[model samples]
Target chain A: MREKILKAIEKNSRIDLKELAIMLGEEEINVVNEIAAMEAEGIICGYHTLIDWEKTSIEKVSALIEVRVTPQRGQGFDTIAERIYKYPEVNSVYLISGGYDLLVSLEGKSLKEVSNFVSDKLSTLDTVLSTATHFILKKYKDHGTVLAKKYVDERLKMTP
Target chain B: MRNPLSNKITTIKPSGIRKFFDIVSEMEDAISLGVGEPDFDTPWHIRDEGIYSLEKGKTFYTSNAGLKELRQEICNYYGRKQGVVYNPMTETLVTVGGSEGIDLALRCMLNPGDEVIIPTPCYVSYEPCTVMADGVPVILPLKNENQFRLTPEELEGAITEKTKILILAFPNNPTGAIMEKSDLEALVPIIEKHDLMVISDEIYSELSYKSKHVSICSLPGMKERTIVINGFSKAYAMTGWRLGYALGPELVIKQMIKLHQFAIMCAPTTSQYAAIEALKNGDDDVVEMTEAYNQRRRFLMNEFKEMNLPCFEPFGAFYVFPCIKEFGMTSEEFALKFLEEEKVAVVPGTAFGDCGEGFLRISYAYSIDDLKVAIGRLKDFVEKLRAEK
Candidate 1:
C-alpha cells in the first residue's frame, strides 16, 4: 500500500487525493489517512514541485562544499553534519565516506555570496581542516525532470 | 474508365471516426482525445530485441504457424495468465495484427450467407471483416444500461439457425465494457445450446482496471469452440509492429495458417522476434503502462461526473463513453461542433455503431495534463450549449 501510494506521489506530487484513491483502488479517506501517517512517520519526507528555473531571468548560484573534519570522540560526523545543516545557507549536508568527511550544498544570491559563506563560516569551523567548493554551472536536469527542451511531439495530427 | 473496385468490398463502411481524424489533421492547434492508440512508445527492451534480430540477419519468414519460439511464449503466457493451455505447434498461428486475426478467423470459418452475431458499438473492423468474409454482419446493439455488456439473453435472442459465429470483443472499444468470469459463464450455456463458434477478440485484455481479463476460452468447454485473438499492440505498445496471433483448436488454426501462408506468408519476422521478448520480459512494462492508463481513466471519469454528463464507469480499455444526449446534439454534431468551437477532438459514439448514437468516446491514452485541458474545454462547451438553450 505504501509502495503504491509512494509511487503515485513520486510520479506526480500534485495528483489530487480523489485521483490517488482511484489509482490505488482504495477509499479516499483511507488514502488521505495513509498519506498523513506517512508524513508523520517521515516515510514521505516532503513534496516538491519541479521548476525549470533556466527559463526565468533570476540570478542565483549553487555550490557543493566538501570538507575534511576531525572525527570527534563519541560525536563523529553526525554532530558536524547537524551543525552544518542548521545553517540557513546550507541546503543539504551529508557525512560522506570519502577523503571528505562532510559534503555540503548551498544556494546563494550570487557567486560572491556563496564563496563568502564557504570562507567565513564553513571553513572557520573548529574541526574543519580542508574545504573544496565546486560551483554548479547549470542544471540540465533536476529531480528526475529534464530542465531543457530536448524533443518535441511532432506526430501526425491524427491517428486511428 | 470502368471502376476496378468490387461492389462488396467498396460497399463495406469505412470507420466514421476517420472522417473526424481528417478534419483534425488539417486544423492547427487541435487537441485530440480521438485516437484509441497508446501514447507510450514500445518499451525499449522490446525494440532492442527487434534490432538484435535484424542485426543477426534473421529477417526470413518463419513457418506460417509463426516461429516455434514465439508460439511457445504465447501459449505459456496464456497458460499462466488465463489458465488455458493450447498446443503451440498446432493451435497457435501468428498474424499481421489482431485485425488480421479477426479477418483470418472469419474468412476461414464463414460460408457465404452465414451470419456473425456482432455486439456493437465495437471495434470498427468486425462488421466489415464479416462482410468481406462473405458472412452477413448481425449488429446486436448493446445497451448502456447493461454497462454495454452482452447479456446471455441478448446472446440467445440474436442467435438464429443462420448464425454460425459470435464475435466477442471484451475490454470493448468505444464503450470500454468488460465481461468478468461470471458474466462470461452465463453466456456459455447459450453458446453451447446454439452450437455457435466464438471469435473472442481479447486485444485489450491487459488494460482491464477492476481485475485481470477473463477469456471466454478459459471457461469450461469454450476453448475448443473459441479463437482468442490477442496481440502486442494494446498490451505492449506495439501497434506499429503489427503482430497478433490466434489460439484455438488444431482444426481451426490449421486452416487459418493455410490461409495466412497464402495471403501474408507469415507475420513479420522482426515483430515476431520482438513479441517473443515482450512475452518473456514485458510483464513489468504492461503493469506500469496499465497503471498509468488507469490514473488517466479515473481522472476523466471524475471530471465527467462533476460536469453532470452521465458516463458509465468503464473498467477496461483506455476510453470513457459519456452520454451527451442531454445536450440535445447527436454524437457527430456534438463532436464536430466541439472540434470547431473549442479545438478539442473526441470521436462521435456512432462511429462504433448506431447504438453508440447518444454518447461520445473520449480516449484517455494521452497525458493527464492533456485530459485536464480537454475536460475543461468540454465543460465550457457544455455550459455554452446550456446558456444558448
Candidate 2:
C-alpha cells in the first residue's frame, strides 16, 4: 500500500484523497492514515509543483556546481553537504561519485548572481578545495516530465 | 461501366464506429470516450530500436513468415509468459497487425459454408472477416448476468457439425470481460468433443487487471487445437507499428504463411525489428502501462457506483460497459442526447452488435482529468433523465 500510494502520488501529489483511495481500491480512512504515517516517518518529504519557469515572464538562472571538498575529521562529506544545502538559494546538495566530492544545484535571478554565489559563498567555505560551475541554458525535461509543448491527443475522436 | 466492387464485399456494412466517428468529428469542443486504442505513445526505447534499424539500412522484406529472430522471440515470450511452447521455425507467422492475423486465420481455416462461432459485443471485424472468408458467422450473444463471459452451456448450444472455429477475444473489447482458467477449462472438453479449432485473439492480453490472463491454449489437450493471436498494439502501445503474429500447429501456420506471403509479402521490416526489441526488453513497459490502466479502471468503477449507474465491474481492458437502460431510450438515443447536451461523446453499445443495446462503451483510455470532466457531465445528464422519469 505504501509503494502504491507513493507511485500514484509521485507524479501528481495534488490527487484528491478520495480519488486516490478509490484508485488504490482501499478504504478512504486507511489511505488517509497511511499517508499521515508516511508523512510523519519523513518517507514523503514534501510536495512541490513542477513549473517550466522558462515559460513564465520571470527571469531565473540555474546552475549545477560540482565541488571537490576535503573530508573534515569525523563528519566526512555529510557535514559539508548539510552546510551547503542549508543556504536558502541552494535547491539540492548531494555527495556525488566520480571526481566531485559534492554536487550542488541552485537557482538565482541572473547568471551573474549565480556565478557570484559560486565564487563568493560556495568556494569560500572551509574544506572546499575547488569547484566547477555549469550554467543551465535550457531544460528540455525535468523531474520525469518533458518541458516541451503540451501533448495534443492525435487519435481520432472515435474508433473501434 | 461495369461495377467495380465484388457482390460479397458490397454486402458487408461499413464499421458502425466509422459512422459515429463522423458524427463526433463535426462537433466542436467535444470530449470523447470512444477510442478503442491505448493513449500511450510507443515506448521511446522501442521506437529507438526502430529508428536504429532504419539508420543501419535494415529495410528490406524478411522471409514470408517474418524475421527469424522475431519469430523466435515471440515463441520465447509465449513460453515464458503463458507456459505454452511452439517451434518458432514451423509454428509462427507474423502479419501486419492483429487485425490482419484475424483475417488470415479465418481465410486459411474456413471452407465455404463452414460456421465460425463468434461471441457478440466483440471487436467489429470478426463477423465481416468470417463472411469475407466464405464462412458463416454464428453469433453467440453473451449475457450481462454472466458478465459477458462465454459459458460452457453457451458453447455447447452454439456448436454444430459445421462449426469449425471459435473466435475468442478476452479482455474483450467493448465489454472488458476475461475468462479465468476455470472458465476456459469448462469450455475445453466441449471444444475437444466437437473437434473444434480455436482462434484466441489475445491482443489485449497484457492489459488484464484481474489477474494474469490465462490463454485457452495453455490448458491441457488444448494446444494442438488453438491458434493464439497476439501483438504489440495494446501491450506495448505500438498500435501504429502494425506488427502481430500467430502461433499454433505447424500445418495451420504453414497455410497462413502461404496466404500472408501472397498478400503482404512480409510484415513491415522495421516493425519486425522493433518487435524483437519489444519482446526482449518490453516486459517492464507492459507492467507500467497495465498498472496505469488498472488504476483508471478502478477510478471509473467507483465513479459509476457513486452516480448510481448500473455497470458490472470489468476487470480487464480499459473500457466500462455501463447499462443506460433506465433512461427509457436506446443506447444510440442516450449517446446522441448525451453528446448533444453535454458534449461528451461515448460509443453506443449497439455499434458493437444488436446485443449491445441498452449499454454504452465508455473508454477509460483518456487521462483521469479528462475522465473526471466527462463523468461529471454524465452525472448531470443522468440526474436530469431521472428527474424526467
Please name the candidate that would achieve the greatest DockQ relative to the true structure: 2
- Measured by lDDT, the strongest candidate is 2
For model 2 chain B, give the 10-residue run with minimal summed lDDT. B14-23
Q: Show model 1 residue runs off by greater than 4 Å.
A: A18-28, A58-141, A150-160
Report the Cα lDDT for candidate 1: 0.90
Best by TM-score: 2
Model 2 stretches with alpha carbons more than 4 Å out: none
Tell me the tens digit of each residue's lDDT in model 1 across B111-189: 9999999999998898998899999999999999999999999988898899999999999998999999899999999
Each candidate's interface RMSD (Å, one decimal) is 2.2, 0.7
| TM-score for each predicted model, relative to the true structure | 0.88, 0.98
- Candidate 2, residues A1-160: lDDT per residue as tens digits? 9999998889999999998999888999999999999999999999999999988999999999999999988888888888899999999988888988888999999999999999999999988999999999899889889897688999989989
For all candidates in order, the CA lDDT equals 0.90, 0.93
What is the alpha-carbon lDDT for the whole of candidate 2? 0.93
- Residue A106, candidate 1: Cα error in Å is 6.3
Chain A TM-score of prediction number 1: 0.90
